[model samples]
Target chain A: MIPLGYYIGLSAILFTIGVVGVLTLRNAIVIFMSVELMLNSVNLSLIAFSAYSGNPAGQILVFFVIAVAAAESAVGLAIIIALFRNKLTVNIDEVNILKW
Target chain B: MNLEQIAFLILAVAAIASAILMITRRNPVTSALFLVFNFFIIAVLYLFLRAQFIAIIQITVYAGAIMVLFLFVIMLLNLGDDKLLKWKLNSAKTISVLLGIALLVEVSYFVLHFTSTEGMSPNAESIGTVESIGKVLYLNYLFPFEVTSVLLLAAIVGAIFLAKKKFE
Candidate 1:
């Protein structure tokens, strides 16, 4: 049977993949994309929960999440670009000038 | 499993596989492209859940707009050959893996315990339709909606500030 559990399981797995990406990937932009993936995965779970629980509030939360994700991507990419210009590199390991 | 279940399973597998490729692939652009495919598969999954509005928004916002932004920046910076794999798992990796295991256990527990009340409900039809969602979204949730817009504005300002080379 097609169950909500299946959707929830898939969502959880996808979110885990995104988390793995964020923790492992070195490129700044790549990490940002992983963050986006994590956000999308969370949205999937939220909407699924909303559909199953008869709550419209979850869908509204999804709307807010999408808007915020867009904004985050913009600012994050800009920061990455600025860092790239400063170091001529996009690798996070090398851009640790602020590190003691 | 039924046909719908099979289909969803296939899509889920595809999306996860591509996500794996996204993080592991050496080329950054390829990784971004894989992410775009992952988004498409996710949008299809959303359709299966009967959230037509969300599926459309997923395509438009994630597949259409955000991906293009990533591609534009990647191309603008000419980071085509920026592929260098970092060896050894950092502490963050260990923590993330543990977190994933915990999430899996929790979700599986809920799945095994809770019985689904069947597919989409009759009321769901009217509640989340484009018309109704818009009505409630703008009326009852008007304050939070406006606040979200302000957040977007701030993000845009932040982006411009970060992208600029100098303050003067």
Candidate 2:
């Protein structure tokens, strides 16, 4: 029998790596990918805890999360494309038209 | 310490490495490819956990549909090497590192203290199978599940509005 800690620890490590990617990467596309990674890590943790607790609720939640994540990526990439077209760059620093 | 564990370790390492490469690669196409590879590895991990339905959904929704959408946008944007926006190491890196360390420390403490060391009863029956999951979802969480579909519709409309060309 595998321990829940093992799964949770793995999820934590993956989540940290994703958080780092979101922080350090400047490319908008890469940041989008990092967000997906973070969502996947959450799915892992949810599934692990669901297995631990013997409840299907968490798994259902994971399903909802997956749906939302897919939709989010679609919208995020679309917005990125629009921004890149108008500004000719996806770099966060140079395209700051909203800076107050 | 068995084959399953060994396979999972390899898949996890591959996934993490591909994810790192995805962030660092200069070519957007290459980065997207690496992201796809990473998703496949994650699907393998889900399979190892005996969540076959989720594994397939991971591949279909994330790797298949979402990535294709990303690639479509990348191509549509026709983004090339823009010298104006180069990625550089910044002061934010320090803050992120510190934050990551703090999160790791907190998770470790929780893992060590809050949770018992008890192993879950290996669910020999179908815990994550599609049929069982669908039954439970439709029966108990039916309303929320339907609401989630509505949320997807809202997101689609929102995305279309955000991407529409503006006329002056």
Which number leads on DockQ? Answer: 1
lDDT of 2 at A98: 88
Model 2 reaches what TM-score against the true structure? 0.90
Q: Model 1: per-residue lDDT, tens digit, B3-25?
A: 88789878988998998889887
B122-163 per-residue lDDT for model 2 (tens digits)? 672377799989998999999998898898898989888878
Q: Indicate the DockQ of the complex predicted as candidate 1.
A: 0.61
After superposition, candidate 1 runs with Cα above 4 Å error: B86-103, B106-111, B114-118
DockQ of candidate 2 against the true complex: 0.59
For every model shown, what is its TM-score relative to the native structure? Answer: 0.90, 0.90
Candidate 1 chain B worst ten-residue window by lDDT: B80-89
lDDT of each: 0.82, 0.78
